[model samples]
Target: MFLGLDVGTSGVKAILVDAEGEIAAAATTPLSLETPAPGWAEQDPEAWWAASCAAIRDVLARRPSARVEAIGISGQMHSSVFLDQRGAVIRPALLWSDGRTTAECREIVTRAGGEAQLRDWVCNPALEGFTLPKVLWLRNHEPQGFARLAKVLLAKDFVRLRLTGSIATEPSDASGTLMFDPANLRWSREMLDAVGLPLSLMPDVGGSAEVLGRVTPGAGKLARLEPGTPVVGGGADNACGAAGVGAITPGEAVSSWGTSGTVLAATAQPRVDPGLRAHTFCHVAPGVWYVMGVVLSAGGAFAWYRNQCARELAEEARDDILVDEAAAIPPGAEGATFLPYLQGERTPHRDAGLRAAFVGLSLAHSRAHMTRAVLEGVCFALRDSLEILKALGLAPAHLLLTGGGAKNAFIRQLQADVFGLPVTTVNREEGGAYGVALLAAVGAGAFPDLQTAVQRTLARRPPTPPNLDIHRAYEEVYDRFRKRLVAART
Candidate 1:
């Protein structure tokens, strides 16, 4: 059995897969997040550690006889976990979704000489989501904590250090830090120097599939795993997610609508958007890369709608009940559009100050129309990423849909309509945990590579083809949505 741990923002998921790529057991333990201030998302590193151990122990206790051969870890990218020389977490980790570093983002650009130079150094624009901004925020606001910083680990690497006693990272996770050179596959010393930080804080880089360390006896006992279990240098959640969904080949992509939405496509080379609109990151597989566009609010926008607007729903317990309510309304929401920038936008417009609104609302429009507008709005926001990827010359054969948003048939069909492409989902929707399990399978010699492991493990659902007629109608509505976004900025 290969064990994979996805240390996510909401929870830590532990998945166990056998030699045939079949899941033997799986468990998820919820995590706690503190928005101590608006736009600041933080998590206690201890909470992640406890949740990871609990999830792993739950799965292991369920299957005591299963011998785990290797381990892999994947997690939310670009979260900053500061550690002292003894490797103690010095402060709560500032998460990827945290949007409190706008000033620091600008500071980084100015320090790098300009936006163009920063992109030249790291192949990514300085966004609040990236780690460098978090580091800078820490330096500016928490100088006492900054003085103790001996090492900086990404989200999963912190968990890996607890499990494997190794201080290292892989190319995929490293590339997202805004301090790593995605093109060269190393830490960006130029950016580090520009920020006046030492290179020694960065961990040694390795391939995602390579075994980086062994499980320490202390962690092994705590999690009911064998000591000396080989732990691979896994990957970022999205990279592992792509591997899990069998989207390793070029022209294939995964459209994930988790808290934040992403449209990710693997590529033959490390390709960056010249305009710095999309991000290029190393894939879990060697010699492979991916370009991705993010929508800061995807299902998250739906959640906000459900809470703030859907108090009258009969099925309040069902989080996706809004989609069902919206299902009664046909395409285009009868000329209403939603901005869906509740937590600000990411893909084409990297504006953290932008907010959401519903346009073209009339007395004739019913509550259901407004609800469907929200659904269509989320899809349209995701479509922004798809458009960016396509602009970069990527034509995905079909989008593999994942996340809670994909559960509703109406939402799935809505995505197909909005994107004008066929959509499918894998039989398992384990997301990053399943993906890293494939990486562990490769590391454990259960499979030779990610492609074979995915082929053996994951099965696809039938394609949900778009209705060209309905799709044609949505073009105008989507245009109105885009126009609202443009008008909002002004």
Candidate 2:
């Protein structure tokens, strides 16, 4: 058996998979994300480690230690985990969704020759959520902590260090740091210097499947694993999730709807969008690149609506509702439209002050109509990402859907209608963890290469296409959304 652990924003999940790619056992532990200030997101690094150990212990308790062969880890990308000289966390980790570093992002972009140079170097514009800006924020605000930084690590690298006593990061996760050169696959000394950060704080770069080290004796005891269990370097959660859904080759993509939504497409060459709307990063698979666009809020908007406006209905939803109330509303929500920017937006519109609203609402609209409009609004936002990919000449032939929101048949079909493409959903929703396990299997000599392992392990279901009439209707409504957004911006 191989063990894969995913340290996500909301929780930590551990999965034990056998040689045949079947899961033997799995466990999860809920985690909290703290918002100390507006636009700021933080999490205790120790909490991640504690949750991970607990998950691992629970999974191992259900199976024999002798069967466990290797371990792999995948986690949220672009989070800054600062370690002092004694290898202890100096401060809480700044997560990818945090947006407190706008000034720092501006400084870096200006120093790097503004937007043009940023696009040339990183294939994406500087954003407040990226690692470099967060580092700069610490430098300017918390000089004492900044001065004590011995090593700067991403989320998964910090977890790996606790497990194996090694400081290293894989290419996919490193690419999001804004201090690494994705094209060259190494730390960007020039960029670091430009941003007034020293390169010494960075971890050694490694490939996704590289064997960093083995679990230490103390870590082994806590997690109930065999000492010296080989630990392979996995990657960013989205990249690993993409791999788990078999989005490995060109013309294939993964559309994930979690707290935030993203559309990822793999390619052989790194292609930056001319508008700087999407990010191009190194893939976990060697010699490959993937482009991604992020929407700040997707499922999060629906959650807010359920908690705020539909509380009573939510309590009775399970038993009384035949289909999800949100799913029952007709296409276009009877001419009503929603702007899903409660937390602002990332892709296409890099606006931080953007607010959400339901426009064109009428007295005839019901609760189901509003709920369905929320879901469709999320899809429309993702379609902006798809349109950007299409403009970049990396149009995907099919899309693999994953994440909590993808479980809803209504939302899945809504995605199909919005994008006018065939949407495929996988049986395994443990995308990042499963992908990490597949990487561990390869690192432990269970497979020869990533491609072969993916081919053998990933299971696919039939494609669900959009209804032609609904698709046509959406095309016209989407045009109106575009026009309205432009007018609002003006």
Name the best candidate (by lDDT): 1
> Per-residue lDDT for 1-490 in model 1, tens only?
8898999887999988888777889999998778887667889887888899999999998898988899999999998999999999998999888888999999999999998897789999999899999999989999999999999999899898999899999999999999999888888899999999999999999878889999899998888888999999999988887887888877789898877889998888888898888899999988889999998878778877877876776655655565666888878888888888876677889887777888889999987898898888888988888988888889787899888767778888989988999999988778888889889889878888887888888899999999899999889888888878764454
lDDT value, residue 363 of candidate 2: 94
The candidate 1 region of ten consecutive residues with least summed lDDT is: 314-323
TM-score computed on alpha carbons, candidate 2: 0.95
Candidate 1 steric clashes: 0
lDDT of 2 by residue, 335-412 (tens): 778888776678988876566888788999987778777788888999999988988887888789988656777677
> Which regions of candidate 2 deviate over 4 angstroms?
64-66, 313-323, 484-490
Each candidate: how many clashes? 0, 0
Query: Model 1 Cα RMSD, Å?
Result: 1.8
Q: Per-residue lDDT for 309 in model 1?
A: 78
